[model samples]
Target: MTETVAVVGGTGTLGAPVVRHLLDRGASVFVLSRNATNVPAGAEHRRVDLASGEGLGAALAGATVVVDTANSNKGAEDVLVAGTRRLLEAGAAAGVGHHLAISIIGIDQVPMKYYRAKLAQEAAIESGPIPFSILRASQFHQLLDMALSAAARFGVRPTGAAKVQPIDPDVVAARLADAALAGPAGRLSEIAGPKVQTLSELSRTWAAARGKRRLPLPVPSWGKMGKAVAAGALCNPAATTAGKDFEEWLRHE
Candidate 1:
């Protein structure tokens, strides 16, 4: 039987590639989001609000698998944790067989607020009725690029001794698409970039990529979150690494 996959937040960076890959695999795809605009071609769009649980039922209907790439930084608790609960409830009601979600690596060890909410979201899915698969990925190259760009506007690139193994979102999207088709395997191996480099090094590489010549200002990793990052909590050495390194991605961009 052909798989019917519903990609929540399918208009976003990682989600868009997931929708495309699923379509390439011959699965019927639906992009569920609050805004119907910018929906990927070859896939249907369904407007659904995760915070309010509005339109979830209709969006999830006839879906054999639901890949949740939806995330909110501003309203983490309301949108990620609570919203995941809502998605699970709706998925269960719709007879969805598999629930796959993308999560950050070391969310358990990291004391960041967003990471805490994501950990809770994972808990909600684990305790829910549906079978699920969770893929924890390292930070994306785009995330670091955006952060560095914002910092550059202030005329200083502040980077601590923290190490980061940034993965490409397209690689993550491909893994998610494969997992959606493979059925729920539960807590798949984490994925990361091939190279683990310090934030300082990455900052320099990014600056060079953009045709700028600025040395990264060394900042101290003071707090618990910073300590965790400095201790390499976010870099999983044993993870299945398959993606473009930060430099490679920068070249393509």
Candidate 2:
């Protein structure tokens, strides 16, 4: 029988891919989503709201692994901290074997609100009764796309002069699912893409992909340490992982 795994908030971008990755590994997967929407075809979906810790027990029951990809809309604290703690408690009660989580590289270096929440999540997972594997990766190229879309809102895209090593989200999803399936290894080595590119450069390249122009906008800090991010916060890549690069992902190679 295939092992069962529950993925919290599996309806979103990162979580959706993670669910697909787990299913590809032959694991019977359970996905929890906020709305009754976009449920993965091969997986079971439980309509649960993580914000209130509602309906988590029924979804997590009898699972070998529970992965937290559920993010909070109320801010990082609600999702990363409160939701993670709740997941840990529920998983512990359910006798879940492992808890897998994804974090970004500059959680510590950047001092952003999201990273701060992620750090709280890491701490919560570390102290959990269940075993856990925490994986840190750099930005996803979709972030560029999201930014571009936001800029398209006002007929202008904002590109910052920051260095980013973007890996394919599908690759990250596959690796994390594999790690979760192989049993608990605790915190894994940080993972990153092969090439590092500036936001300005990547934005331009990505805009060209969408038949748009790239416009770099110099702005002050917005998040926790925005200036620090502009100064290259996520600077190191994991020695292992050896994932594909941005160009490779873009070319669909």
Leading candidate by TM-score? 1
Worst 10 residues of 2 by lDDT: 235-244
- For residues 1-253, could you state the per-residue lDDT of candidate 1 as single tens digits? 8999999999898899999989999999999998887676789999999999999999998999999999789988988999999999999999999999999899899898899999999999899999999999999998999999988887877777998999899999999999999999999999988888998889988988997766468889888988999999999988847668999999997
lDDT of 2 by residue, 166-227 (tens): 87777778888888788888888887777777776676766666776635565555665776
Candidate 2 Cα errors over 4 Å, as ranges? 220-227, 238-253
The lDDT leader among the candidates is 1
Separate clash counts for every candidate: 0, 0
lDDT of 2: 0.77
TM-score list, all predictions = 0.97, 0.88
In angstroms, give how far residue 190 of model 2 lies from its true place: 1.2
The Cα local distance difference test for each model comes to 0.91, 0.77
